[model samples]
Target: MGGNGKFSRWKISFHRAPSAAKKEPPQEFLCPISNSLMFDPAIVSSGQTFERACVDICRDLKFAPTLSDGSKPDFSTVIPNLALKKAILGWCSKTGSGHPSPPDNSEIESTIRSLSGSGGTLESPKIRVSEKELLKGVTETPPILLSHAATELNSRDLNLSSSSEESVIANSTPLLPFATRPSCFSYSSSPSTSSEFVAEEGSRNTASINSSSEDENFITKMRSLDVYEQEQAVIQLRKKTRTSEEARAALCSERLLLALKQLLNSRYTALQTNAAAAMVNLSLEKGNKVKIVRAGMVPPLIDILKSGYEESREHAAGAIFSLALEDDNKTAIGVLGALPPLLHELRSGTRRSRHDSALALYHLTLVQSNRAKVIRLGAAAALLGLLKDRDLAARVVLTVCNLAACDEGRAALLDVNAVDCLVGLLRNRAEFSSESTRENCVAALHSLSDRSLRFKGLARDTGAAEVLMDVVKADSERAREKARRILEGLRGPETAEDGEVDWEAVMKGGVTQARHRVGKSSNRNSTEF
Candidate 1:
């Protein structure tokens, strides 16, 4: 709400009006997401503009960031940003900003291919291992993944015994003694062990492929008809992907995600919950987050939120909360109709559901459209209802602060007697452990008071004036500043309704009185002389 000596609602203005007088092109000519002058600016469903290709890639990947107001751009429909595009073209002609040509379709495709790993994304790195470990890996106390990795050295036709293995030394000569590379051959020097070395060398490529094959088989099992097999598959998936970043990355491809998405809608309670839990585990790997959503996991997850089993709903919410943390997944989740159900869970679901749903809402609401949607659905009243218990107060209040940013949110909050609710929390601040609750209480009140005439009376009625003054004197600087802003608004009315002066009447009366005094004085002066 910071403004230039005037009241302004919170808006994310990434661009400014172009003035031909200025030498530089106005910031609005560029796309915020791409940080480049827009050549083909296009508006998506939320009425925000970006480079057209940016939108396409985002949709194809099912990735978008949450905008500031808690809503995300919906790429389902697009309109050419004709006006802005025209202005940008005009400016480019005048200023000659020397902007480079925007990327072409082929370049964009290449980027998509690279990001999705479709275009030469795989690279088989030479596995690094010590000589001792390479020998130890085959005997198998604990399997060494690096040892099992394909060096493909046999394809090079290098008949390396122990001397040649030592000679290669990791593609560099100096680090030979300490570092060794893994491949199809064993690190044996004796001519007698040549067969053993060759056999070991040959197994590396097969082992690596089999390892990859084993992970793919998980998807097939997950989609199996037998319930027990599906259950076991989910269990093994959940257990394996839980701690292994490698496993999550390898297992969370398109087919596996589709299979998991199917299980998310499973009528069986245990399978649904386990699948959801495994999703949460998989999403823990940063690389898998966007890919999971790209595979269309969101719609099924929403199904779980709506009518899944009690235990499953929490996992569903947990998965959503996890995915929402990713910048790209935020929009897809919100756009796919997760917002209202999440708010529903926040209000009436399990303790865990309530917790995760609250968090999901916090991220999803960053876009303006989503904020309005939640407020319209009565989120303000629902959130205020949770404040009755101080135990839930601190956690839920962060989201309350977010809701207070918009006009609808503030109005909705005020309608729900939020001023009174927040003031009461401030009065008993010592009872709560989190200063943030008290801080947020003051902030929500500050936002309410920002441009509201009704807030003055509400604060005066709640004795918010005195409580805020105390905070300004004693609370943290941040809380105190917001308290000061609210207090400033509460100082007094700007003008009195019934206290206007009758200036015209006063002037006429004054002239008549002066003339009467002059006539009386003239008569008296003649006699006195």
Candidate 2:
């Protein structure tokens, strides 16, 4: 990862090659880059997997290859596909095929050169006029090379962190379901529901013409010189995009993204706040999340969060939270130094800022890298300090639960004697607080109990063992299950070994179970067998 703020800066060198196999390998096992068995598979940020060496070769040549699925792979960052590599090797062994070796970097480069020479060039998707018509399939190649997207974005002079991959055909499952958008955006009771009203007139107005004309009209207005015009355009765009899923998708053109990126720097407070608010609406649509980040909005948004006007800063935090919903954007967001400000927001920002920051932290903390980044930010202490504020405690507790999922987070939490804070929360079970807050507290403690050797002692010292027993009978089934496990862990292994089973009774129990379950009513069932 590079500090130049360009998103596509991950660098990994790979060199290996094997002979062509006699048998055809699975399509997915073959790197999209090499079109051969991949000795080393790596995932990129935009949810595409490729060979490690092949990605390097593309980076070396400053190429962004379009896939068979018609979408461009965001080669901003890459991670070793340990699971996929293991699966590929196992498949090779099962079929008695030789293991795939990495092709020499020179050989891969030569192949790319030949392909590009034979008309494999691509237009930048960012500036494409018919942005909506860019077919976004998951695989395939255009017979053309694309100017590396990162190069074009670097002209922004502003920069941030790198990127990575997501899914292949076989690795299509997400770790967690994106069941809801950032609820803090509208202060809605339901996670996915919006309190904002849909723009019914826009729907009726766009009934005759497609969204292209409407989108262009808005993009044109958004980039206008007049602050009054720009402000009006942003307000309209924000309002239209708020609850219109169609507007959100159709208006997410690269031109519009770039326009919004510029407006985020507006000197006028109203327009800047509107830009941030529009960003939140746009990001609610799943397709726009990664696009918004790639459009270079992150750097300016981070700037706003760090020192913008109070109202706009609130929207800025909300925008960042919304963008982080996509798993691909999580790493880049954290690597760009979002953690410290977010932690600061949790400690001092307005109520909404704290809530959105917590939500963003919750999603960002899901990955190990971000967890470690945030832990290094002294997040454990900051989050624990927020527990006293009941309004923010629910999300704060949930975010802590995410942190507890990783070993580093667990260590950090334990360092702060979080055992006492969490146990007290569980024991008190504030009458005004939501059950989920206490449930998440239990969940965090449970996660800590799993790996920390000192956790049992901490739990017993805080009277966590007794508190957990009470939670075991509480309303939340999940909380109860976790509480039961924590209680069992606190009991120690010695208790289980002390109790011995009666062999004679066990043997009788098995024979008695077989008598009723083994056969239907029959006098000679055993004789028949």
Candidate 3:
């Protein structure tokens, strides 16, 4: 009995012990379905046996086995779980030595029956073992079972004769029970107790799967909704207008003019034009004069007047006209360097552009500096050219009248022959039939005549006195009033009282007549040699 015990131990050691020639650890099996270390392996009635489905699953998932080659198998092209099938088939062919051929569909059942007992009774029939029990008897149970499972599945489709099956079964040996626990294999045999655990696990998986998809759908819906809302908002804003209070507020804002200047560079032409137009309209408002000058927008506007598109030039001209009505902006007009381009526009631009240019120039000349620049830029000739245009002539005449009201501007005007131009425009009544044109011309001449006694003689020599007389004969009250004032100023001292010129009589009798009478009286008082 002692020798038998020693022999049995030796046989177990020979079958179970690792070979010294094996440099790498043995391969393990993984379950194809669960993708985990195979456990609770069992032989089913369908002629198939899985020793470690869990280990086979792990191998299929590319996990390391308890005793596997250090180098990983190339799995780039391997389908998921294919490693399990390959492991199972290879294991079966090597393990089953030479047992007689089992029935094709009953190999697992027959093997189980042989291992437990051959009796046809419930107690004799083989009992299925859990993965924990199978691991207890094998040193490398995880890898061995995994390899066996992979080998079986992979070889199932291959031709295998009964003799080969017998050979494999006869050579097969049961693995001895291991002394230590298998490191890479484990199993839970506890029966499930509650439905909530299953439901919770399933819900977690479903939530994870749908999270990205749900977020994408939400973002798509929000973007579509935002696009519609933004378009509607733009349309509604366009339809709204500034209230009276808002207009007042804009007039008060120092940034209003600056903001309009910046809009001149807008990519949208319509927006640029609209902003410029709004600025022009704003400048025309009562009490908004200070805002226009203090905004430091005058220079850019003048630049626009000189070089911007047609619409911008018109708007800039209008703004200048509004600012010119104020004494402050009038002085700054020359600093604007706007006279040259303004005169050019007045002479050659479209009717609206020309008109605005003339108006702006008219306002600018009301200031001394502006009058100087006008003379420097040859505006005298430009103004003279407009004498042929009755409408332009009237505007020019009114602006000249205002300029001649100041001493410095009057001198500058006379220096540029502006008085002579006015005289010529007045005498050319054939070209100016409009009552307003003739009236403005007469008023301008009268203002010139009132500047000095010498201007009275000059006016008469230029035939301005006759033009005033013709205007006085006209039926229009304004024409007669302007013509009468011009004639009175031309009459000179006869229209003076208490060292103050009789402004009422001069306005009524015309400065031309007043200056003419003064010139005759002065000649008489001088007495010839």
Candidate 4:
């Protein structure tokens, strides 16, 4: 009786131990479905565990989980395997590695679903993940399930027998889990919770994900394509990015801007134009301007202005115009020898390119260092030529006026016959120009004729006397005041007091017929010059 009882106890203990050990997961912790390490293992109704995302995908597909023993188990009922999840958390914390949070069963089930045939084949026509969904930060494609689907399709196409198909599926393994994927790839699991955690932690990090995903996808597409395809991709990227300010800001990374700089060098016209357009948009952010300039963008932009298509020239000039908004870029552009090409565009490019080039030079010349370079580069002739067109008169005149502030620029303008052009425009102000033009023209004359009797005489020869008298009657107080000063300087004390001519008497004499000429060597303050 004692031996019989002992034997029964021993037999019961032996049977229970093997059964429990069998139910325990392998020491390596492989997902039952994907046959990969279960980063976040979860249990389902069949009393088996798989990676959270992997098995949830399986359940969504109504696919049975293939067990370790080469048998299929029902996975209809899903539950988080808390014990396994805790283990994974512990391991990651202990190793100081970041583990991706698990996928939310409810959210995952709604956003994405796999379509598998009765024979377990995946169909074509993949559903695209929307940007809004991506921003929520929890959505990802189920690569493991997709891998299984692909294996199933391949098996079906080969006309494998049921047993052979099972063998193939069993041996197939998906790539690494999301947590283990290369740093370049990102997926959001358990989005609502992760987002809340991220928000509580600070949502600023989420903005990086937006840029990262876009940058990664763009780089991948760009690297895989030929030049023509890259051009098309660049055009599409520009189109998509232009519509979103956040996208523009997000794309303002050093790596991507360098790619754009390289694109600017492409011989393909479309690529050159599109790359210029993209740089224009990206440079809208002040921070990106410095990055773009440092990436050696100016020289290529100058190249584009020199030889690119008309639209490319316009965009490239416009990009430089935008970049020149940064003071640092202004100096850099001038140093990179951009003035010659820019001046060429101002003289001969399309109207848009001409205006854009002028705009760029306008900003670049704002730096004192660049002012001398622009004047040295012969901007005076080009600008004076454009000034004749009434539509471009104000901008051209304003830029010339600014340039004329420096001695070298004033001397350059006088040498290029800018005085005659400016005086002609001033004389025809009411017919072809605005009050601002009158003021700037007066300022240009002031800068040019202040110390040089030759420029003053040149102005007088071009009917400066009549133009100044008419300007004195102008409604703009600044214009009226400026015109009077020039008229006084042009009128000699032969009319009255030391330097004060009678303006009332001068007006009575009729400005067109008036000859108000100050002494050639008048004693006006040279310091004012």
Candidate 5:
């Protein structure tokens, strides 16, 4: 019996009817340009087979061979076969036809059933299933034997039954219930032998079971005990901050100051400018005026004022202006000697920075200890130079006039012939079109008149007297009042009766007293030129 069993197994394995061999391995083909496999096959006008089709067949066969030798099979044998030729011709004809007909509803349903499954569970809901009715007519019979009986019954009854009765019989008959029906039986319309149905059902069930088992195995492998815990640990780690205090300490440390100094010395203009401004803001907030003054920032600020970058120079001048306000910082600012540079900035810097520097100088000059130092540093000459700047010219004139109103500042300013510069600016104001310039010029002359009658004589000598007379007659009341005062100073009793201006007597009586008297009716009426 063992020998017989082995013989049977051997016969089944080796002597079984031979299946047809797969077609020959595809040919090797190359592209002319790249000398590599042709990527996509195409037919051209040439009669001979080109590289493309052969290359594609070879590429597919390289990974998966239709034959077992691991070599590309000869394509010519397959290409000439009648069945393959017919299939190829049919595909080409369908593709080349102008418009292919769409599949009928039955064909579409068959294709969907083949792909999804013959089970009613897999079938779409649009195709109705009468499960209870089908089972009721089954009569407790086996499906294969019952289907044959049903076929025989259907044929035999055709002769006796009327068409309506046949329809009723067809409706009442149940060939198979959905769950018990073999997949192949559900697809086959002809109720014949059940062997083919069993074979197809076995194949489909085998594939579905194998695929489900693989999916379950893969899902089981992917699940891990520590995954959630590890993810939570990562999130917790990200939330922790160990170096926040260290980072803040580094920013405010002396290293930051050194970095700032290096940045100020950087070759890049933008870096230098930005670092300088940042340092200025930080120092101003911290009141570290001494650090700024000692770091030689003043000279660089003056240099920046001379440069073309207006914004940098403006901020630099502003920083210096703040420093100049502090009495303790005055000596340091004076040591770096900002007055000369500030004066230069006032003369040559952008209009905004020039005005700022002028205001700073004005404040600096107010410090009695620095007043002599400013004059000695040629600040007077620098302010006189700014009289030519269109924006700052009027401002410079005004500042000088205010300084001249001070006895000591006025004395120092006069020593530099600052009066001559003022008179020159007044003479230049006549040609300007801006009313502000004209008004400022008049006001400066008025301030000068409030200083000394000699300034009044100087105003008259420079034709400022005529300019004031014009302003007095103008419609603006402020201009009129300003002009009226200057006129009285020039023609008032402060002048000698002999028509000579007594600057010495006016200086002795004080300019404020003379200004008060000039507004009086007695001084205006009784006094003569």
Candidate 6:
């Protein structure tokens, strides 16, 4: 039995026959990858058993196999062979050499017997189990055994039953009660009334009953739908998901997100709209945001933004806005060329799409490199076009401020006549406009004022001087002070030596004025624009 392998000691040795008296290890128990008796075995899609570690190694190579038929199976299709794993565990327990301790198998055996006839043959249920029937069938056995039995019985269903050819079909006669069905079993909390005998097994049984009920409901809904009806069903499901946080979280599953990504390419406008809407809600979570972007959702989202229905474009822009929340996603989206489509949305989409697109650009331009990319994509001109939209004015102003943080951005804005737009916003000071929007507009103009005497001359040329004078009398102290400083800076001498209005002193005075407005004398640091 002492072969030259790591698992050599675990092999079962046997003599061929009485006459031959030659020893050979059992082939069925050996793992193909390691060529030794398996300690932890699993099955691949090819129906071959290998040590779990070997399967993982194959997965790392993308499951590329040097096979005789040149067929390569996807690594994702590999599944754990629970029956073989348990058999090995039991064999080790029986030998008392491979296993140090083993769980109780007697309860597992009893649970199996409860589902079988006196002769050990399973009995098919006459009717599907209902909620009341499942609650009545709660067992005292460990859930771990039931989970393994489900896997084992499933394998037996393929091998022993003649009616079905699929390996995963449950046997015609379920080995366990439908209440304890593996497809939907879960662990739940015990009832508050049973404080004395609140066993873990009872809690698990209760959870399994509830889970089976939910599974049945979902199946019934799915079974009743045709192809077109299914699309509508998904739309309704998306609406329901928006109202429940837990449902939104559940939509974050990789399979579901991938499905949504595929649905982005659907010919049906309603399907695409609902899929994008669902993804917008799903991407609210940080992890799901990363997953949605990584699933190649950004490009299709941009496409939807380009030419989808009115509501679809809004949802697509909303999804892009959510994905832009992460710093890494901001770069990923930009690298995927999201800027152009976002700018396109700003220029021509509905008012809501323009607002959401501005928000997406706001986050993306937070990265300094993306600022130049956005300006290059003609964002400066597009933002200038949206400046008049009162509904989108504040976000459009904020995005301009972010882009105008640098000289190149300022130059681009000046080239696109953004100075005229900013001054126009300042001129009216609409009663509906927010204080933040006015502040952002002034901040962008101030950054533009930093470039050169020529650009400052450009501000004055764009009637910025008269607008600043008007803004100087506004109610907000910060707005008044920023306007006065720009007014003085543009009007004062061009050289730095000209007692040129000390910027720090001016900012300190502005903060002082702000504190004075609220009647606070305590000194505080001046906030950066």
- In the range 1-529, model 2's lDDT, one tens digit per residue, is 3565444333221111133335677777988877888876876545456876676556545577777868677655454566778999999997779987645555776777665664435332222111122212101212121111001111110111111011111111122111011010112121211112212222222232267887788888877778877876776676566434667778899888888889888777666766777776677677888998888888888888888766667777777777787799999998888888888877888665766787788878888898888888787887888887766676687788888888888889999999998998877764424555676788889888885668866765776655766676554677888876765455444332334322232134332222232333333232110
TM-score for each prediction?
0.54, 0.56, 0.44, 0.55, 0.39, 0.51
lDDT of each: 0.61, 0.62, 0.45, 0.58, 0.42, 0.54
Q: Model 1 misses residue 514 by how many Å?
A: 41
In model 3, what lDDT does residue 114 have? 42
Q: Which candidate leads in TM-score? A: 2
Of 3 and 6, the candidate ahead on lDDT is: 6
How many residue pairs clash in model 2? 27
Q: Taking the tens digit of each residue's C-alpha lDDT, what string does model 5 give over 1-529? A: 9999999999887844433342222232322212332222222111112233232222222211232333332221110112222344354454442222211223333433443344324412233224454333233323332111011111122211112111111211123212211111122223333323322222221111233443233233223244333222211111110011111122332434443454445444444444444444433322455555665566766666556255556556666765565667776676666777677777666544565576567557656556667656656666666666654553465456555555665556655555566546545544443444455556655665674856654554455554454565542455567766665566555433434333333344433344444445335433322
Compute the lDDT of residue 242 as modeled in candidate 6: 34
User: Candidate 5 at 64: error in angstroms?
Assistant: 83
- Pairs in steric clash, model 4: 138-188, 490-518, 491-518, 492-518
Candidate 5, which segments miss by more than 4 Å at Cα?
Answer: 1-259, 265-270, 283-315, 322-332, 349-356, 408-440, 450-453, 475-483, 492-529
Query: C-alpha displacement of 511 in model 1, angstroms?
Result: 42
RMSD of 4: 29.5
Model 3 lDDT, residue 457, Cα: 58
Task: For candidate 1, write residues 40-121 as lDDT tens digits.
Answer: 6765544467776566445534556565567666664443455777788787777756643553434543454555454533
What's model 3's overall lDDT? 0.45
lDDT of 5: 0.42
Best by lDDT: 2
lDDT of 2 at 171: 18
lDDT of 4 by residue, 368-437 (tens): 8988887776668878888888656655776898788888888888888888988888777555545555
lDDT of 2 at 350: 69
Model 3 C-alpha lDDT per residue in residues 1-529, reported as the tens digit of each score: 9999999999999987644343321333432223323333322211122343222232223333222324222211111122344555555446542221211212333333343353423332122344355333333222211111001111121111111111112112113111111122111112122112221221121111233443343234323335333222211111111112133333345433444455555434343433444455445444666676777767766666666766556556666665666777777766756677777777876555566666677767767677766765655555766767744554566566666676755666666666667666656655655444555666666566564766765665566655556666653566677666655555544434324343443344445434444455445332111
